[model samples]
Target: MTAPITMFGPDFPFAYDDFLSHRAGLGAVPAAAHGTEIAIIGAGIAGIVAGHELMKLGLKPVLFESDRIGGRLRSEPFKDGAGAYAELGAMRFPPSSRALFHYFDKVGIETIGFPNPLAPDTPSTVIELGGVKHYARTKDDLPKRFAEVERAWAEALEEGAHYGELTAAIRARDVATIKRLWHHLVESLDEESFSGFIANSKAFRELGFRAREMFGQVGFGTGGWDTDFPNSILEILRVVATGADDEHRLVVGGVEQLPRRLWALVPEVMAHWPSGTSLASLHNHVPKPGVAKIAPGTTKKFAITDRYGTTTEYDAVIVTCQVWLLSARIDCSESLFHHDLWMAMERTHYMQSSKTFVMVDRPFWRDVDPATGEHALSMTLSDRLTRGTYLLDNGEDKPGVICLSYTWSDDALKWLALPLDDRVRLMLHSLRQIYPTLDIAQHIIGAPITVSWESDPNFMGAFKANLPGHYRYQRRLFSHFVQDDLPEPHRGIFLAGDDISWTAGWAEGAVTTALNAVAGIIRHLGGTAHPENPDPIDRWSDLAPVRLVE
Candidate 1:
């Protein structure tokens, strides 16, 4: 009934709204299969969503979660309790994420413009690089030199990548035009790193190293993308062209609310259960054990063994966990997937992220400075160990949250071995250097919370960020959700996650990919996509990812 929810991002102009808007039915779950159980692995957003939707189509979905339900969209409340919390993962979300926004709107989770480092909503930003402190509320407030660097970067996109042409084609959903524009980019930029793109681009070449270095220190849109400098240019271009790195917002409670709510959201239809069927009702109130192994069955249909060595069989299985788990954690049979697909899963590199949060008595940073008379310091970017510092304002009455340090890559690795106290001390020392006169320590009301996703056994890294020359690898993984091409044994098992999405690191990608997996599972089980809202394969040639070679 409503307009289709599509991401106009040139990388993959997937119409998620089309899939959701299917009014009649998702396809044929044979009369015999109606009540048959489908095994859904990893109770993260992708798995929860796929399970939720499949249940509506008269299939019984048994969701198995190894850890928490939310996955990388982690929102940890203060030790005192819930509400004022630190987002160890996925804090800010972009407005352009229509698929993700759809569910948020469905559940009535309110969102407010996030005050990201240099974005328009942030009251002020302090760029501390090379010991010099520069302050601004916007790009206009930034120094002329830095402004020119930003301009040069924008200009380079227009000329070098045909940014305007590609963006327009993507927004128009002109698949032919998108393929024409993107294929060239895939060929030209796949092997080239982000740093390489800057060096080769006409504008950056003209501007020289200083401009490139400046761009690295305080990046365009999101904070320093320098850690991503070695990744493919196509990756950055997609984020920039889609406007995903701009016009951001954060959930009032936490971004994780979207998935967590979906976990408990009652399905409209129930196959074997009563009227109001939720994920919890499908399983007993007790939590399920972690998955230890998955393999094609001799007669059990599909075999799944839990950590406790309990095994179960299902007609189909959907794996929504990080790909690395298949290799390092799960004892899956080599025969389960093609070698190339397995290689892609193993090669899917996930970037490390570190976040430290402390509760302050109030929004103390909003106060005036004694010496210079500026709001003490709102958001900070620095060359120090604390690469980016964000201030979260809960309320004037309630305690505010200070994300003392948020760093990625090697910068994150620095705090890995340190205890919470030592990490907090290092962050405080780094902050004191930027705000020399402020006694920021005095306002602290609670112990700091910290996380290194890289150190976590369950999650190898925060989210996926494809490397240069890895487009081929991603294309294989992205296409795996489409079951028609798979061998018979692989047909019943589906792969779905943000990692398997083109626009990795965003919730919309996870939702879109999850929905694709849902469609795949339907077709695999002899169901058809609704006529009005066809499956992705129905529009594959035009919308499929650009193959670099062969």
Candidate 2:
């Protein structure tokens, strides 16, 4: 059984154990609903998990992927193919993400603590501020100024956001306390930006904007909170208060395997469908064409036209693609969903991101500097062009990988037009300025690969970060997964992905939302959640996610 999660705001905070412990087959497919076919858009983690679980419940799910499987959970192999690869997206997993771990454990994925710059698993960290450099192997070694900034953030959360009370209420599953505490917060903080919260808070007010500047340059968890400073304060509180930023681990081989393994799994038995049916068998071991358009069909079903113009009919469709695709890429009908839902999807703010990586001969940064007696290079962070650098050591005699640079938002936008070689050169140039004596280029043994998510049509941008005053928009999107929230016309289609979830940018949100949609889909098809286990919304409706409209 999975652990129970405590959360704030509209992020569905439900017990994963309840989902597994239900007596009825998860979603409890009805005799009439047996062999119900579901059309799942996108082959990302969200789509794959939803499709996989639906299959287990005796439903047939056909997945369509415009690109390759795994979507954003992709791992790119280095050019020379020396078994070295770079995690182009989603490189770490937090222990608090029980829903994600459930899948990871089932797939037998091996994980170790990711070297998160100044994190414990990392041997050292080099932080650059202004023009000065400070090298430290632990948090204690950080300059006093950095310590002050960290404390201010902690204190700001406690006073300005009521972080402790909210988390404690959630941990205890005290619904009454949670609703009272969180509803007040949503009203007060919904229109507030992260920077605004930090500015007016007692600790931050005393420390001033300088502290805010440092936090933005090298954020504690995801790095460079500045890009997100304009985002809702509630979003940041949900991440830190829930312990989602602590105790992170990286999948050993690659995180993408979690989804890939699931695709290969063939259930022992299924309804109507033959035993040992897999996604490959269902699609004839071929790539299902991309969906070009979606509209309501003549009957109470959905009509999805593929890239090749072949239309398919299904009782329901779960769109796992990012919201922007509905407007920017696909030819979706306006009448298919509520006008408010269209606004939310169109207004979603996807943060820009870029990552440049290279394969190296070995972990040269592990070597001690002869003059300073400190390691040659630690996982580094700076306000320079190369905002942050990460190292991946693959043991002796194996090629090592270095994320030469990882940046976000405006910083990321700077390199959106640069070619891979230009990006690598500029990043190395910035690194040389920090480490004057080290000739880092000599260690390179393979071709470099880079990603500018905003430039890629498949992925308009990295992930979502809700902007100030966007609660109503998010509420519309998040609740869309629940069939009851929609009007008669929109009842047959559902939305599930990180963007629709409260905790965007995390895989946990993607998986959790997908599960929620699965239950909703079952309900829409006249099925039911197990009698032993009430629906998540039904069980916690009193403590339901904060309502922006009501």
- Give me the displacement of residue 263 in model 1, in angstroms: 1.3
- For 159-238, candidate 2 gives per-residue lDDT tens digits of 97677777777666666776777778888999999989988889878887788899888777656678778889988877
lDDT of 1: 0.82
TM-score computed on alpha carbons, candidate 2? 0.96
Residue 63, model 2: lDDT of 92
What does candidate 1's lDDT look like per residue over 441-474, in tens digits? 9999878899999998888898888889899999
Q: List lDDT for all candidates, in order.
A: 0.82, 0.83
- The total of clashing pairs for model 1 equals 2
lDDT of 2 at 10: 32
Reference-based lDDT, residue 441, model 1:
90
- On the 0 to 100 scale, the lDDT of residue 76 in model 1 is 87
Residue 529 Cα positional deviation in candidate 1, in Å, after optimal superposition: 0.5
